[model samples]
Target: GESFDPRSSLYLYGNGDGPTSTATIDFAAATGTEYADEVENVSFRINDIDWGSGNHTDVVTVNAFDA
Candidate 1:
């Protein structure tokens, strides 16, 4: 399921390689204000996360909309 409201808040997405480590996603909004800007791919970085004991891959989905 997607977050109910993503535009007004900061959406953090992530994925994990294994139980040893995890990855984080970073996004750059077209502009600082959510209402006056469009969303773009920006970029992402991996951060403290877990991949569930190397058994399955973790994926994070972000839901963004015009505020």
Candidate 2:
């Protein structure tokens, strides 16, 4: 398992007028260190979703690599 700074967070806000939205999070910037070369697993914690109405649905997609 790995640990990250509790204060580290990435937020992306979309205007709700587009079919898709995108953002990038630099792990080195967020953790103050580069990701290890052998890393095989990564995880994310998502919160504070603003489902304005009861009929709204959201999909989250994440892509990670050793760039």
RMSD to truth, every model: 11.2, 5.8
What would the TM-scores of all predictions be? Answer: 0.23, 0.43
* Candidate 2, 13-60: lDDT as tens digits: 655554455777654443555655344456777776655565355667
41: Cα error in model 1, Å: 14
Task: Assess each prediction's global lDDT (C-alpha) against the native.
Answer: 0.46, 0.62
Where is the poorest 10-residue window by lDDT in model 2? 28-37
Candidate 1 residue lDDT tens string, 32-66: 66554344544444344435555555555545455
Q: Candidate 2, clashing residue pairs? A: none
Runs in model 1 lying further than 4 Å from the true structure: 1-54
Residue 53 in model 2: lDDT: 64
For model 1 the TM-score comes to 0.23
Q: Report RMSD for candidate 2.
A: 5.8
Residue-level lDDT for 49 in candidate 1? 45
